[model samples]
Target: MNFKIFPALVLAAAVTLSAPVGLQAQSDDPAAERIPIMRSNGMVLRAAPRASGDEAIAAAQTFVDNFAALPALFEDPAFPGNTQPAAWDNFDAFVGIFDEARQGAEAALAAAQAGDMNGYSAGIQTVAATCSACHGPYRRQ
Candidate 1:
């Protein structure tokens, strides 16, 4: 899974999400259900200090590939899960979390491609930290 396919995946998700909807809440939709799973599974090996460059790059691309559309999914008011009001109150900062994650993943990909496994590992940490960044203020727990 190359990062080149990211834009197309995001575009497709946007198109799918933009379709007409009934009054029902989207909390149970497959996309909503898949978001957390993706986030968890996508980073399962992020903490591995010695994963091969190939493995690291593969993980980075997989994250970018699957996560490109999450912002759109999360933007839906009726999406699943309890979002803290501060997320909407400071929406730009909330969205910045995703931006940071994407940048980190991209940097990881670049680092792995360049045979810099150390930087790739650090970039994975950068990517992982965004979860805490967003969750601190944007997730109800």
Candidate 2:
């Protein structure tokens, strides 16, 4: 019950619990890491159009944050197994899709904040389309 020992133990336990989840997402296999993020974003994007302004804003924020995790997950040579080599060949364009998605998410968030639900819905849908644009040519069977 010593105060010093108690806080240290709590910190240690939290780190112990978190390390595996963090490490697993950073695993060598891109698919393992990418699939969950994609699914989560898909859920948000799918529901965002029907969501209220506040809900759409929240979804957009989640997408903005999620963007940070994606770029590092794919590289030129070693990428998600489902990714076609064409993505690497047209790497700049491929990367631009992600940037465009993030920007669209940001626009959605801004529109929701400004009380423009129509703009918000449109922006969110545009962001969702980025997946198809990238995957159409870039995803292998």
Candidate 3:
């Protein structure tokens, strides 16, 4: 084989082999595009709890049900990559914090929908505890 032609073919083969690998890795990423959206929505919703209520309580219930997705925001995509910055620490701790809050939110929404004043009050307390506990640990000034 001619040296020049051999080098060119080798380069071409390498590129062909690498392109799909890169695309496959990207496409398979579980966190891709999810973490940022979750993070943004968490901030937005927390800032405006009233937004959670503006929709009919029925619609709010649906939103509250999906709250489990919130913790994805703080996750680092390139976790363990040497060149990447540190990912958020204690994901399980953060999840516990958010899960409590999410449950309270769901409970509150449910109570409000049922028009149960006592349940609503209790739900509010639960929600407050959830927010304060998580915020105490992870929220920064």
Query: Candidate 3: TM-score?
Result: 0.47
lDDT of 3 by residue, 1-141 (tens): 788799899986874453232222234443443444334335534543443343435333433543555444335445322212222566676667667767766776777677654665565566556655655555543
Better of 2 and 3 by TM-score: 2
The list of candidate 1 runs beyond 4 A from truth reads 1-31, 37-48
Best by lDDT: 2
- Order the candidate numbers by lDDT, best to worst: 2, 1, 3
Q: In candidate 2, what are the lDDT values of residues 1-141, reduced to their tens digit?
A: 899799899986874453233234456676666776777687887788888767777788777766656665666366547788887788888888889998888898899989899888888888988988888898885
Off by over 4 Å in 2: 1-27
Candidate 3 structure lDDT: 0.51
Candidate 2, clashing residue pairs? none
| Local distance difference test values of all predictions, in order | 0.66, 0.76, 0.51
